[model samples]
Structures are given as C-alpha cells and as structure tokens.
Target: MTTSKTEGKQCNLVNHDEIWKVHINMELESAKSWPQKWGFLTESYNQAMQESSKVTDRILKLELPEHLRTRPPTPPEEYLETTQAFIGWRSAVPGLQLERYGRVQCGKKSFLKELGWALDGCS
Candidate 1:
C-alpha cells in the first residue's frame, strides 16, 4: 500500500513537469510571433544580423596599440579611495533627478499605455 502511494505521488510530479514544459513552449512561440507582428521584414532581420556580426568581429579583433593599454601609474589604494568617495557622494544625493528623467524619457509612452489598460480593466 505504501509503495502504491509513492507511485501515485511520482505520477503527479511527472504531470506537473509536463504542464510546466508546455507553458514554456507557449512563451517561446509568443516571443517569436512578436517581432513578426511588429512588422520586422525578413531582409531587415538579415541586415541587422549582418551588422551585429560585423560589430562582434571588430570587438574580437581589437588590439589596443601599445601606449593606450599600458597600466596606469596611480597606486591601487588611491584608486580605491577615489572610487569609494565617488560612490559615497552618489549615495548621499537624495532623489537623483537624472535617474527619474531617464525613466520618464524612456518609459513614458509604454507606461501610460500599460496604465490605461490596467485602469480600463479595473473599471
């Protein structure tokens, strides 16, 4: 009887795993559909991929000419103290306006669209 109960629990676990796998597959399908729905043409996608490859190749081939890559003369302790002071000043500033400005500039349209959808659902 105990063996039967254990077997039943194992079967339930397998079913749960299968359900989770199906959900992940659906999400992947939705992601693939999004770019197409956004009117991304095939040639555009290919061109973008080619540009990305070129950037990647350039990064991989980069060799800084001898003068630029040389080690800095500053002692490590001085560098560490300067970095810490900069970080402390940044932290001490309350309500960093630059961060808020960036969010407002980047997210204003999307945020309002989402907020409208959410408010509509509430009503």
Candidate 2:
C-alpha cells in the first residue's frame, strides 16, 4: 500500500511538472514574437500619424468659405488617440520589462489586452 501511494504521488508530481513546462514554453514563444509585434505596431502608428498630419496640413492650407469651413472633414480622432497611446506604450513596455521576465510591473495579460484594444481601434 505504501509503494502504491509513493507511485501515485510521483505520477502527480510528473504531471504538475509537465504543466509548468508547457506554460513556460508558451511564454517563451510569446516573447520570441514580441519584437515583431512591436515593429508592426510602430509601423501602424507611424502611418496613422502621417495620414493625420496630411489632413491637418490640407485643412490649414485651404481657403474655403467661412460658412462651409465649419463642416470640413476632420482627421480620424481614433487614429490620433491610438498614435498617442502607442507612443506611451512604446516607452512603457520596455521600462516595465514585460517580456524580459515571466512577471513584471504590468501584468502580461493586462498589457496584451490593452494591445488588443489598440489593434482593434486601428482596424
């Protein structure tokens, strides 16, 4: 009976170890993609900022009638906010060392959720 109990405990321990390994592997894979994801986000925000700038410049240069100018199409507000948020995140993610360790100042899941929100706004 003692031998059976020891075997059962060992079996449970092995399963627990396997679960931890899988979790670590998943985190490592995510870390590997962090740079690529960051690059894509940077490119997206840059494009949005450039487009917003062009629209602002065009509006500034235009000499339309005073009455009609009131209804001019403004640049996308969502993109502007997104660009700003991206700027903050760009500095913050590294400062927090989110990808460097399993845990950091900001929870990884929370950071990913915020990232997803930004991405959804872009689309």
Candidate 3:
C-alpha cells in the first residue's frame, strides 16, 4: 500500500511539473508576441547600455596610436533614427520606465508583479 501511495505521489509530481512547463511556455509566447508590452525592450536597452559602458571602458583603457585614435568609429545614422523611433514609442506608451540607476520603475504593485514574473518561482 505504501509503495502504491509513493508511486501515486510521484505521478502527481510529474503531472505538476508538466503543467508548470506548459504554463511557462504560454507565458513566454505571450511575452514574445508583445515584448514592449511586457517590458522586454526596456530591459534589453538597459542591458545594451551596460554592455556599451563596458566597451567604452575597454576602449578608454586601450593605449591606441595617435592616428588610430584621431578618428573614432561612428555608428550608422540609421542607428540614431531607430533610437528616435523608440523614444517616440516610449513617450506614447505607459509602461516600464528606467530609473537613473537603470532599474525598472512602475507602480509598486506592478513592479512587484513584474519582479515575481521575472523570478518565476525562484527564491
């Protein structure tokens, strides 16, 4: 009887795991379909800014020759245009905003909910 009960519990656990996986996949699909609505763009931009900062630090550390340093590399104008488009989108949307320290900001409840979503069951 005990052995059968143990097997039953194991089966239940397996079913629970499968259900969690399905739920997580659905959440991911929804987020992917509307990434900006889910704050993915803000998070991505914050990460990119951090990476850009790291690259800038590395470049500053490098001791390049005078001629090499004379003309810094420039990004294509399209990059600026894309950034401007994002800025316009952000102004029109009411969603996640970045704090001065790169942290995401929204209402307390919304921020907590987002934090919970990000944690995804992790302690």
Predicted model with the maximum lDDT: 1
Model 1 ranges off by over 4 Å? 1-38, 72-123
Better of 2 and 3 by lDDT: 2
Residue range 6-89, candidate 2, lDDT tens digits: 764435667768999999999999999998777688888999999999999999997985433333334787344466664565
TM-score list, all predictions: 0.24, 0.25, 0.25
Any runs in candidate 2 off by more than 4 Å, and if so which?
1-11, 46-123
Q: Which ten residues in a row are the worst by lDDT in model 1?
A: 96-105
Instruction: Please give the distance, in angstroms, between residue 30's alpha carbon in candidate 1 and its true position after superposition.
Output: 15
Residues 1-123, candidate 1, lDDT per residue (tens digit)?
224657644356677789999999999999888777865587789999999999999998999864335345667766655667656655555553336554444444555475667645543
RMSD of each: 18.7, 28.3, 27.3
88: Cα error in model 2, Å: 43
lDDT of 1 at 104: 46
| Clashing residue pairs, backbone N/CA/C < 3 A, model 1 | none
Shift in Å, residue 65, candidate 1: 0.8
Q: What TM-score does model 3 achieve against the real structure? A: 0.25
- lDDT on C-alpha atoms for all candidate structures: 0.68, 0.67, 0.66
Model 3, range 1-123, lDDT digits (tens) per residue?
A: 224657644355677689999999999999787855767678889999999999999998989764333334357773544667656755444342334356566655655476667645556
